[model samples]
Target: MSSIIKLCSSLSSRYNPRLIVSRFTVQPRLCSSVKPSSGPSSSSDHDLKASHKVDNFERKILVWTGKYKSVDEVPKMVSQDTMERARNRMRIKIANYMMAATVVGCLIMVYSGKKAAERGESVSKQNLDWHKSYQAKADKTEKDYASKFEHMAREGAEAAKAN
Candidate 1:
């Protein structure tokens, strides 16, 4: 039992199942010794950093739980075998959900881009049609102006000759 407890404690430290504090000591103050500047907690920044880290971890756990809607914390109040099985089941379920969601999201993005490309191709075709119509009208106008110029020149020459 003692060995089991020690093992559990060791594993907890390694996995950080929860926060732990270390012991501290104070020096014996003499008349010449200046008064201590601050308490151990106040003097050490480790506590602040540890708390921040713990908070971040807790937030991540909360988010994961919210998204999955089901998960169990370690040291579960059940048989060890049952807890292990549950954890394994949860891991598999979460993995499947994440993979399915990712695949669906990727598919949606790909199809959306394909739709946009199709729309762009249709718009380009319309623009090409407009260009072709405008070009045909311009060609007809140019031909009409050329024929009028030639007719005017021929009539002018004939009038001069008669004069």
Candidate 2:
């Protein structure tokens, strides 16, 4: 029993999770004895070098979370040329959208005009058929009235000749 307990304790100590994790984790180091840089140029140069070292992956991991030791280590979020190109792309996309919309609107207008013309032609044909029927009725009524007047005139002339 004693030997077994000793073996367990040794194994636990050797495989301590905290110690294993700490060995792999990189801890931030504090510089207490180092003096500040003497000149502004030297400090600025150090900052420039640090900033240049911050690539996409470093910037993503270190800068946003404030994990960097100094503010100078953070790089610019985006370059000027990249920003300009993005703006130009946006403008071009908007122009393309507007052009497509204009073309669709013109197509719809043309289709509507064609439909309206077709409807107008049908309506005109119906109106012409109705006018022709009305004109035939009017001509028949006129002929009936003229024949009645001529019969009355013949009767009067025959009566005058007999008297």
Model 2's lDDT to the true fold? 0.63
Q: In candidate 1, which residue pairs clash?
A: none
Q: Estimate, for each residue in 25-127, the C-alpha lDDT of model 2 and write its tens digit.
A: 9444322235667675665655544433335654444433444555466556444443444456666766899999999999998898799887775667879
Tell me the tens digit of each residue's lDDT in model 1 across 1-163.
6775675467566855343333664333232225666755663554343332223333344335443243433222233444344456668878999999999999998898799887775667879999999999999999999999999999999999999
Ten residues in a row with the worst lDDT in model 1? 70-79
Which candidate has the top score in TM-score? 2
lDDT of each model, Cα atoms only? 0.60, 0.63
What TM-score number comes out for model 2? 0.29
Candidate 1: where is the Cα deviation over 4 Å? 1-76, 121-163
Q: What is the lDDT of candidate 1?
A: 0.60
